[model samples]
Target: YDSCVNSVSDPSIFVIFEKHQVYPEYLIQYTTSSKPSVTPSILLALGSLFSSRQ
Candidate 1:
């Protein structure tokens, strides 16, 4: 839950959940696949955040 993270990507909570390592089913509840259109850069940014957290 970082303030800076809120504004990044699509501003969708689903993106944030994936960033935090949540399950895809969980994401489905919050968002549909039709939206957000996953991108490599978003994953990279989340990966960086994950490693930093560890």
Candidate 2:
């Protein structure tokens, strides 16, 4: 898992997950400026991450 946090023009968080053959790679991005709520985006990404493990 590689993560990057940038706070330039638009503050945002980016995550990259490198998986094996059994799982697919996931790129999770969260922007702080555009959206009014960030929980849904985080929850959605986490849901996908956990579900893929099963």
Candidate 3:
């Protein structure tokens, strides 16, 4: 998913995901507790990045 990662402008986050999920099952717990959807968080991240650069 090169396009997806590039779209984020933050491939390292995915890299961490790929490398660091020491316990795969914990991902389930983490996701369950996280925002219902990633869209809002991703939008917030993009907004912050753009705002900071300006």
lDDT of each: 0.61, 0.66, 0.56
lDDT of each residue in 1-54, candidate 1, tens digit only: 433344566665433433555435544335456565779999999999999984
User: Which has the greatest TM-score?
Assistant: 1
> Candidate 2, residues 3-53: lDDT per residue as tens digits?
444764776764445444235468788866864666888999999999999
Runs of candidate 3 exceeding 4 Å displacement: 1-38
Ranking by TM-score: 1, 2, 3
In candidate 2, clashing pairs total 0
List TM-scores for all candidates, in order: 0.34, 0.29, 0.29
Clashes of each: 0, 0, 0
For model 2 the local lDDT of residue 52 reads: 98
lDDT, candidate 3, 11-33, per-residue tens: 55433344444445444333345
Q: How much does candidate 2 score in TM-score?
A: 0.29
Badly placed stretches (over 4 Å) of model 2 are 1-38
